[model samples]
Target: MGGESNRWAASGRKATAVGTIAFRQQLAYKTDFALRGFFLLFILFVFIQLWTAAYEGDFDKAISGFTLKQIVWYLVFTEALTMAAPPLCSRIEEEVKNGDVAIRLIRPQSYVGYHFSVFASEALTRFAVHLLIGSAIAWPFVGPPSFGGGWLGLLALSAGALTVTFLLLLLVGLCAFWVEETSGLYFVLQKLQFTIGGMLLPIDLMPEWLQRVCAWLPFQAALYFPARMAVHFDPALLVKQLGIQIGWIALLAFAVNRMYRRGVTKLHVNGG
Candidate 1:
C-alpha cells in the first residue's frame, strides 16, 4: 500500500510536469502572439486619439483624477490584464458536457490541481507577453509607468490577481459537473468582470456610490487593483491593496478546493 501511494505521488508529479509543458507549448506560435499585440496596439492608438480629441476642448486638465495620458495608459494596463486570463472555464464546460473528464478521473492526480497548474503556467506566459507588448506600444505615447517599490510588488500582485481569477473560474468550471452547460454562467461572469472589475473602464472614474459598492466585490481585487497600481504605482496604496489581494486569493482558493471536492464526488457518483 505504501509503495502504491509512492507511485501515485510520482504520477501526480509527472502530470504536473506535463501541465507545465502544455502551457509553454502555447507560446510556440510567436507570430500569432505578436499579431495579438498589434491588435491591442491599434485599439490603444484609437483610444488615445479619441481621448486626446475629447480633452482638447476641455479647460480641465484632468477628468476623474486621471489626465488624458493616464486615462489612456490605465486602459492599457486593464485591457492587457483582462485579456491575459485564459478562457479555460469554457474548456471545462465542454469537457464535462462531452464526458471527457472520465479519462482524467482515473488518473492518480488531483484533477483541479492539474488544470490549475496549466492555467497558472499559461497565465504567467500570457501576462508577460501582454506586458511587454503593451509597454512597447505605450512607451511612444505615455512612457513607462513609474515603478516605485520595484517590480517585486507588481509581480506579486499580478500573480495574486491571476490566481484569484483562476480559482473563481475553477469554481465555475466545477459547476459544470451538475449543470452540464455553463454558458449562462460564463456570460455573466465575463460581463460582470468587464464592467465591474474595471477592465474596459477605470474604477476611479466610476460614480462614488458605485465605487463604494464595487470595493466590496472580489472583482476589484482580481483585476482592478493590480492594473491600477501598474499605471499609477503608490507604495501606500500598494501595501493596502496587497493585503486585500492576499486575503481574496486565500479565501477564493479555499472555496475552489471545496467546490472541487464536491464536484469529484458528484462525478464519481454519476460515473462521468
Candidate 2:
C-alpha cells in the first residue's frame, strides 16, 4: 500500500513538473503573447463594427435570436475562451515528426498523460494572461451580458465545456497518427464548427435542416452550446447539452485509445 501511494505521488510530481516547464516557457515570451491578445481585441472590435453597419437599419429588430448587444458579447467570450483551449494533438504530432516524441515516450510517464499535463498548464497560463485580460479590456467597451444561472451552475457549465473542448481537441489530435498532416483537416473541421456549431451564426438562425444536422454533431457541444448556457440559462437545456457532451466525450475517448495504440506501433520516427 505504501509503495502504491509512493508511486502515485511520484507520478503526480512528474506531471506537475512537466506542466510547470510549459508554463514558464510560454511566460518567457510575454511581449509576443500580449500582442496576440491585442490582435484578438482588434479583430473583435472589427467584427462588432461590421455587425453594427450591417444592422444599422434593423437595430430595433432581433436577428437570429440575438440582440446586437448579445451577439457582440457572445463573440467576445467566444474569442476569448476559444484560444485558451489547448492544442495538444498538434504539438504532439509535430514532436513525433521531428523525433522529439521519442524522448517523451522514453520517460516513465505515459506520453498522452504527460502531454495533457503540459497542455493543461499552458491552457491555464493562456486563460489567465490572454482570456482574462482580454475580457477585462473588452468589458468597458461591451457591458457584461446577463448570465441567467446561479454562480455554481455557471461554473459547472464552464468547467464542463472546457473539459469537452480538451477531449475533442485530443481526439482530433490523435488523427496525427493516421494522417500525414492535420493542418488542412483541422482547418476544415474548425470552419465547419464556425458555420454549423453556431459560432459564426446562432443555430436558431440556421435553417431547420441545418439545426437538425448540428444537433448530432460534437461541434455544437464544444463552443456554441456552452456559450448559449452562459448567455441564457435553462436548467433542462443545460442538462440535455451536458448529456450529449458526455456521450461524445466517451465515444471520442474510445476512438483515441484505439488510434493511439495503433499509432505507437506504426509510428515511423524519421529524423527530421
Candidate 3:
C-alpha cells in the first residue's frame, strides 16, 4: 500500500511538470508574454479610475468596510483570479465534440489529471502576471504596502480557490459528454461567477441575507474571501476562511473525480 501511494505521488508530480512545460510552450508560441503586463496594466487603470470616481460621489470614506484604495485593490485581486482560469471549458467541449477523448484515453496519464496539471501551471502563471501588473498600476494611486502576514494566508487561500475554480470548470466542461455542448452552461457559470463570485463587487456589499448565503457557498471563497483576507488581516477570520476554502476544494475535487469516472464509463459504453 505504501509503495502504491508513493507511485501515485510520483505520477502526480510528473503530470504537474508536464503541465508546466505545456503552459510554457503555449505562452512562448501563442501570446507575447512581454505584452501581457501592459495589457493587464491597462485593464487595472480602468478599474482604478472607475472606483475612484465612485468614491468621489460618496460622503463617507468607507463603503461596506472598504476604503477607495481597498476597493480598487479588491478589483485587482478579483480580476487576477478571473483572468487566471484557462479556457478549460471550451477546450474540453471541443475535445468531446470531436471525439478526441478516445485519443486521450490511450495516453499513459489520467485524462482529467493531465488537464488539471495543465490548469494549475497555466492559471498560476497568468495569476502572477496579472498580480504584478495590477500592483504596479495601483501603486501610484493606493501607495505602499497594504499587506503583511496576511499575504501568506491570502496566498495559500488563493491557491485553494484556484484549485476550486479549475475543478468546477473541468466538471462543467466534462458535461459535454452528456450535453453534446456545454458552452451554454459555461456561459451561465461565467456570468454567475462574475456577479456573485465577488468579481464585480465584494460579497460584503450585497444584502445581509445574500452575504450570508454567499459566505457559505463556493463563489465568494474563490476571489472575494482571499482578497478580503489580504487587506483585512484578521487572524481569526483567516483561519475560518482557510477552513471554508479547503472544505470547498475537497468537495469540488470529489465531485470532479466522480463525474470523470462516470463520464469515462459512459464514453466507453457508447463509443467503444
| Candidate 1 residue lDDT tens string, 5-47 | 9988897787669667967688687887878788888887887
In candidate 1, position 136 carries an lDDT of 77
Compare candidates 2 and 3 on TM-score and give the better one. 3
Score every model by TM-score.
0.86, 0.85, 0.91
| C-alpha positional error of residue 111 in candidate 2 after TM-score superposition, expressed in Å | 1.1
Deviation from native of the Cα of residue 30 in model 2, angstroms:
0.7
Better of 1 and 2 by TM-score: 1
Worst 10 residues of 3 by lDDT: 29-38
Q: What value of lDDT does candidate 2 attain over all alpha carbons?
A: 0.71
Clashing pairs in 2: none
Q: What is the overall TM-score of model 2 with all chains considered together? A: 0.85
Error (Å) of candidate 3 at residue 61 is 1.5
RMSD of candidate 3 to the true fold? 2.2
> Candidate 2's residue-wise lDDT over 178-220, tens digit each?
6757777677777876788676666887889989999888777
Candidate lDDT values, in order: 0.78, 0.71, 0.82
